[model samples]
Structure formats: C-alpha cells, structure tokens
Target: MATKFKPFDVVIARYLLKPNEVFHLSKPLMYGAKINTGFGSINHDDIIGKPLRSIVFGDKDKKHKYIVTRARLPEYVINVKREAQPIYPVDASLIVQAADINVSYPTLKSVDDTEIYKEIDIFRRRGYKLAKNKRNDIKNDSSSINKKEEIIQEKLLILHGPINSYNGKTITRCSTPPLQFLECGTGHGSLTLQICKSIHASNCYFDGINDLSRGSIIHSLDRNLKHMKIGISTVSGFQKGIYLDDVEFHYEPIGPSNWVNSDIANYYRQLCDTTEFLQGCFLDMPSPEHEFTELSKYLTVDGFIIVFTPSISQIWDCYTFVKDNDLKLTLVSTFELLTGGNGGMREWDVRRVMIRNSEMVGKVVKPRIGVRIVGGGFIGIFRKIP
Candidate 1:
C-alpha cells in the first residue's frame, strides 16, 4: 500500500511570543515527542492537523500559543545556535548589492531575433486597436510592466544571519568577479558561509572541472583547530539545503609571508599559471599588514584587496602600506551605529580613491554615507596596479 500525504500533516510550530523557539514535526504527531515552551509543553498532536498560520495553545497553559507555520531560511538562521557573532541580514543585503553579486539575464540580439520576431508577428495578427484614453492607460501600464520585468530579471537570493561581519564586508567587496578568495581568519566560519553563498550565487564554477583547482574557490585558514571545527560545522549547517561546494577549510595558519609554503598556496599557483588569476583577497589577522607583499604576488593586476581592523591606528598603517606598494587605495569606509534597539541606525563612511588602469588616468569617485546603521566596523579597499 502507498502512503497518503495530507495537508498540515507536518508543520513547523513557532512560538508567538518568543519567535525564536520553533519546532518541526510530521503529522500523526508522535506522542512522546513534545516541544516544551517556557510556559508549558506543546503536544505535537495539537499542531498535527492544524493549518499553517493557525494559533495553537499550549496544553498546560492556555495563555501560551504558537503560530503554526512552515520553516523559512531566515527564521532558521536566527534560531540556529551559533558560537560566533553572525552577520546581520541588513549588512548581508548591503554587501551582496554593493558587490554586485547578481546574475544578469540574457538579452535578445536584434529585432530579427526569433523570440522578438515571433512576438511581433503575433501582435500584427491580433490587429489590436486601442481607444485614445485606453492607449494612454496602456502607456502608463507599460512602465509598470517594465518594472515588473526588471524585478523578474534581477532575482536576489538573500539568507539572513550574523554570518557576514565587518571582515565579511571587506571580503565581499574585494572578491568581485568571484575568482580566487583567501580568508586568513575563519573566526566562527560565519563569513566563510557568506563567501560560499556569493560564489555560488554568482555561478562561478570551474568549467569542465569539479575539483577545487577550477572556478572560484575560497581558502579559509585558521590556527585554532577547535575554531576550525566549529567553523566547518557552521558552514555545513548553512549548506544543508543549499549547494556550496567551492569552499575549503584549512587548519594551518597563513601569513602573507609564508602562504606560499602551504599546499593550498601551491595549488593556487598552478591555477594562476593555467586558467585564472587571484582576483581578490581578505586579511583579518592580528597583523594583516605583514601579508601584503605575499598577497601581491598571488593577486592579478587589477585585483582587489581588503583588510579589516577595529583600530583606527591600523587603518593608518594599511593606508601607508598601500601608498608604498604597487597598489592604489580605492576606498576606506567605517561602519557605525546611529540608532539602537530592534530597528537601529547604521552608517558607514565611504572614501573614494583613484587608481590608473590601462592608459586611463586615475579618477576618484565621490564618497557617500550609508543610510542604515546596524553596527560599526572599518574596511580598507585597494586595487592591485600593474
């Protein structure tokens, strides 16, 4: 006999008051498995046949109720246990947008393009006529239709969490073109997951190769084995429903000076010689300044480098290093909080710098301030100049 599936057979129970405590279970609720809210125990049977969005009260406490609903990624992210501070959703959204982690839809080549010609012929056969007022209405509606089309053309896949931190922002900005990305300090792997998501969303896969040697890959290096394990677990949890196989974790510590000695470094060198170049890198160590020279060797001309530091003094050190090296300081931005509480104020200082590319003279774009203020951090962006 085949099993029959019914609506509301399985449901995710969300505490109406707490919003954080959520439980997922199948229908024909197991009698022994009951979720305990602070107020009381919620029996699985109470929710098994209830429709999604229905409110069910706790068995012991009538005052306590749970908002039955399906589990979502953002909710899961918030409720998931984390060892390190994860990047907030607002910051992640900004990072994705600023870094242009978007896929562009293909465009028709010419008026004679097959799809275009077919559409035109259909319109001609319809012989549709519009009254003067109706034509004006259609003209107004065209703008809205175009807007809808634009929205469809650009799809934003965003996951909310505290995964992307200040360092994450720098990594996202530098890792444009989704080439080779190196993260010196993995922390809790919050940023690692974000990087993996970006690489996957950008569709930066190694063509004809499934190994780490091809396409865009992230080398996450950390010294502490425990932290590395935690980071890996965190990333694995994030990748549960999503596909992000380009990220590799390493336990060895990487400094700008000795990175070449590492096995991954040799792999990257081979990749550089054959197919692609190191496009971007992020350094978040105690002394990121020391690794600049070593990073330069691996980075391609016109590549991006970003360094994160909490101290304003470190920013000065990085600025001086960029000036002395064969790189151009493009932007120096610091995130700050303007408001507090649930919906808080967040802002960042954006500094524009100029660097010569090809025969074109260097030009600095005007700096602007970010409107939202979630939290504060500092980032320095540099471009590798040949």
Candidate 2:
C-alpha cells in the first residue's frame, strides 16, 4: 500500500469513525484531507503507536535548557558546573481518521460485534447506491451539512437572549494546515484557546478583536485565554496565555437592518493601527454589506474577512449592496460551519468576491472555522489581497 499510494499523494474517501479508534487520541476522527496527515507515511508506528488525536493535535517538548548557577564543583572536576535542565513533560490528545482503502469482513470484526460488522460490510459495498437514493431524505435532516442555505435561515427562527451570546459554536484559528481552522459553535472557549496554543506551537503569532468586549462570550474567552503569553516564542496556558500582539474592540454603531456607511473613517483608522496582518473582527455593525465595501478599502488586496450572522438573507443582501454601490464583487465561497439556538443559529459566510473576483488588485477568501471560540464562532484564513 505504501508503494502503491506513494508519498505526497492526495487521496479522498468518507471514513467512518469508531469511538475506540481514537481512544487516548486527540480527536476521534481525523479527516484524511489536505493537511490532517501526509501521503505514503501511514505505518503501524505512524498509525497505531499514538492515538490519532495526539498525533494530529498534541504537542511534544523537545528543547533542552540549561541553568548556569555557578557553584563549587566536585574537588578538581571543575570550578564552574554545567547542568542541563530535564525536558518538561507535555501531553495532549490527538485524533486520526484513515482513508481510501478497501475493508473486508475480517477488518470490520476487529472493531465491532458480529451483528454490527455485517451491517457496515453491506454498506461498504452498496452503501453509495443507498445514499444516492435517499439523498433528499438525508439532506432534509436538521444536522445535515448538505441542506440548502435555507437551513441557515431556518435555524434563525428560534433566536433568543443576547444576539451575540453563545450560539453553541467553538471558533479557533490556526496558521498551519489540517485542523488549522475549526468552528464547532458549541460555545466552548477552551476550543479556541487550545487552537491558539496549537498555532503558537507552530511558531506563529495571533491577534484578535471583538465588538462585544464586555459580553459574557468575551468575558469567558478572556478569562480562559488570559494566561497565554502574547509575545515572541513563549507558551502559556491560563498560566501562559499570550497577550495577543494586537487586540482591541471599539464602538461602531449600525442602524437597524442593512445599511452601509461607506465613509467609515473611524473604522479604517483602527484597521491601519494594527501591526498584525491577520485579525478577527466579530462586530455586529449593521450593513456589513456596505461595511465590507468600506472594510475592503483598508484590506491589503489579499486580506480576508469573516462575518458571523444568523441571517443568510443578510449575507445575500450584501451581494446586492456591493453591486449597487458599483463595487465589483463576487462570492468566492459560502458555507455554514455550525448552527446553534441560544442566540439563534450562527452562520459563517465567507466571500472572496472582491474589487473584481477574477483579476485581483486584491482578493479575499472565505474562512473556515479552525477551532471553537467562546462566542460560538470559528477562526479561518483570510489574506490581504496583494
């Protein structure tokens, strides 16, 4: 299989996950996607030695530090002694998912009982046909990701509490690949904090902004992530949380419904002040459609934006607003990463439709949630189109 598949090759398949498969691992299922794992690198050591979650997401301590406290050495050994500090222990759970391979009756028996094994084996061969037949039925299911945008609209029907409160999503951002971005929307701050740790682990820097600074979402997030150290190559949990290199939130009032204040001078000013190229803005300013136009002005052509809203209609409305304003626009991508009920189902729609999608003076890319943040949002990649 190693020789057949080769290294650096790309393969795709829908892998079914068993809970025990990821036991003692980080995540239960590792999607054999672009970044999760490499090609031709699958082996027992690669596969079975460590749990999938740990391999994919966990961190290891490798550096050696020294404490040079000058003291008397043994008789003539040396006046000054050199001692190396022991490596600190690091532990984390990781998840892995296998892909693109045939399974037989024997392989199925390894994980499940006789009755269950039989069902999966039947699906293995003829399941694709069954899926196609029931595609509509599968789609109509509330949890299905295949449903049309109307599902995003439908989730908004039961909005309650603070509009920006936890919508049951976890939003985290990472600069690296694979789980580089995730947005669970379960409203767990730890998910984002953990991802931030992972990004830092990759030796990358992070900065962020939130419109609702005092909101519980932020309060929980701040308390949880406050311990991370913000500068240079330092790692801190709550004990070592990074004081994000650049983070700020300001007031930008938006009228009811959709309206765009194209001349958003103040907003532009804040944008210019940031040193970090990547930033996340979770502001609920009205007319994001128009604000995007104004916001586009400041982006470095390749810069991207992540807008969270419960209204898919509003996102569509943005398309029309950009057109009417004579600002050339196109939607690069749009998809719902998660849905929730507290503050309504939060929808993340990314549009790369820029000053002109094709020939970019600068372009935008919609972000996919990398990890969950406190306020039911995800972090994604966006570049300043240059």
Candidate 3:
C-alpha cells in the first residue's frame, strides 16, 4: 500500500512555472476540503491516501505538474508563518551546537501507561486513522468495527498529531525536557523549536506533559500575547505536536516584576529546586541586559547564556551590566552574524573585560570592521562561573 499524507503534516508543493523558474509553497496538510495553490487546486479526497513525493495534484499537462513532498525542519521553519521576526534558520542551527544541549532518548521512565491509553482511545473514538504500521499492522474495519487508531485529531475531525513514520502510531513524547533551557524572547518560537529538535532524543513516545523536576525542554517566554499564542499554536501544529511538549511557553520575564512575584517561581523555590534549574539560556530580545541578573540566580554553575543584540553597542551594555552588577558571569565568545548576505557568522574580537577574581582584568580592542554594514546581529556567549 502507498504511504499517504495526513491532514496535519506540513508539506511542500513544487513545480516549474517557467523553464528557469521553480516555484515552491509549504503548508500544513489539513484535511482541507480543497487547497487553492494559485497554480491549481487539490481536493482533499484526491490527496489523503496518495503516495508522497508524487504529483498528487496540479495542472497535470505536459507543461505543468505540482509535486507534493514532506517539508524538512529548515524548510518548514523558513516557510512557516511568522508571529514575529523569526530567528533565521541559519542562526538557530548554530545556537543548538553552541548550547551543547542533551536530547537523549529513554531518559525518563513512563509516568503512567493506562492514563495515556484513555486519551488514545478518545482520539480513536473521533474516527481518525493512524498511518498503518508494518509491525503492529493497525487495521480498519468499517462494518466489522475493528480497533481504532489511538492518537489525537483536531476539532475538524482531522488527524492532527504525528503521522507515525516511526513504528508506533500511538507514541507521543509528552514528557517535559530532561534538561532545562530558557529562550528569553520567543520571537515566532522558531529557535525554541530548533532547540527542542536538538534534544528530542532524550524523550520517548508517551502521551502528556509531565511536571517533572528535570526533563529535556526549552522554556520559551514572550510578552506579546498574540505572538506567544501564535508561537504555541504554530509549534503544536508541526508534525502533529512532536516537539510541542518539549517546549513550554511562558508569559513571565525572568526579571523582578515577573519571577519575583510569580507563583511558578515560588513553587520552584519551595521545592528547593536548584538541580533542575536552567542548563542554558538564549536571549533574542531588546535590552537583554535586564534579564542577566535574575537569569544568573537560577542558572546552574558553568551554565551558558547566549545573547543576541542587533548592534555591538547593546553587547557593550550587557558587558557593562554584568560588570557593574558584579554578576558571576563571563563574556566567553562574541560572534558577528551577516544577516542579508548568506546567513554567515564570524567570531568578532571583544575589546574589554576578561574577569578574574571578579575583576575586569583585560583590555584588547581592534578596529571595527564594516562600520556601516548591518549584520543580522552580534551574539555574546556568557558562562556562569563559580
């Protein structure tokens, strides 16, 4: 039997408009009654059970063919809708490596198996098919009324979870992150997804998010209500919520106003939870300096915080804030990213502050390069020192 496209999988459609022009559009494969691609329209009935990477829809004449294929992470990230300016895929990729996040699988034991089965049962009751598994061989019996596929479906009666390419159609990585990470500014939640993908291995297929002390995760925070909601919705919609549980969204900033009065923080404090604290932090907001002090408190020793500033001057402000506040943090690496050109990133020289014995003990400055060339941003990597 040919593999099929599920209602919620993000997919890509490509065709040649002219001999030299290739056009591509990426969208979630909803059980959409009909999808208008401008090039043409593909009916839901025609596409649901067709083989992938095949021309399932389009102007099928010799002159034009619309090819449908699965969208890769980078492709999906760039092409997906934006709630705010996205952290370009180029930058997001590097941030993962720099963070050295742990996404190891089978890290946590199953919390509850039967409780999960109920949700699966509910998912099946709604009448959605789980993509057939070769091993388990999930069968459909309309008249005989056989066992139902046990995953979630959207309100529209569309299978909105994952299309089980992995053996078990019933698996969901509902565990919290095995390691804690903070994305200070959840702009469009793009980088949050990148980090989750990096550490997803630390999780296994189970259903439901656990309020565990330590699990693999990236906690994304944004103040913009619309952007925050969109970020969560966009991520949850991907591949049917694969990384959705891996990320937890927050409206609280780490600063005094939010965390100081936050019941969430009080809960962590009541438990005396230092071991489950942040392993890494990424800042992609204006005035990231405001976050450093509070972030320092929960950041485990030797944990790293990476800040993204559009200008070198803001980096200086971060440096000044750290030094003046006597925060036990060090500026470890400075990178200048080329934004509009090739998404290139290069190490830039920092002219000040090598802290030793909690003192600014060094001064080295080189002439600025390309004074007028606006790169994507400057990134400062800081480490929490004992």
Best by TM-score: 3
Better of 1 and 3 by lDDT: 3
Candidate 3 lDDT by residue in tens digits, 1-386: 22787776666666644312444544556565655665577665565666787775464453456677777777777777776888777778776666676555554444343544433222232323222222333444445431221111132133233332223433333344346677876768778888888877665543432233234656677766567666776677677777876765655433423643354443333222343377778888878888888788778888998988888878878887998899999988777777664676667667566677886677554435754312377788999999
lDDT of 3: 0.62
lDDT of 2: 0.26
Candidate 3, residue 174: the lDDT equals 31
lDDT, each prediction: 0.48, 0.26, 0.62
Query: Model 2 over residues 247-335: C-alpha lDDT tens digits?
Result: 11111123211111312222222222332212222222244554555445444343344443444555556655665676533444343
| Estimated TM-score for each candidate | 0.57, 0.27, 0.72
Lowest-scoring 10 consecutive residues by lDDT in candidate 1? 121-130
Higher-TM-score candidate among 1 and 3?
A: 3
C-alpha root-mean-square deviation, each candidate: 18.7, 25.4, 11.5
Ranking by TM-score: 3, 1, 2
Q: For residues 1-386, could you state the per-residue lDDT of candidate 1 as single tens digits?
A: 11322232334566677765445433324555566655667676665555557787766547877777654444434445566555444433343333333332222112222432222111100111112122122122334333332332221111111121121111111112335677766666655666666676443333222232134667777665556556665565542424335565555543545754543355455434433256677666676777777777677766666665665456557656666674443443433322223433333443324554655434232224546534334455566665
Query: What residue runs in model 2 are displaced by over 4 Å at the alpha carbon?
Result: 1-240, 243-246, 249-286, 338-386
Which has the higher TM-score value, candidate number 1 or candidate number 2? 1
Clashes of each: 12, 61, 17
Q: In candidate 2, where is summed lDDT lowest over 10 consecutive residues?
A: 91-100
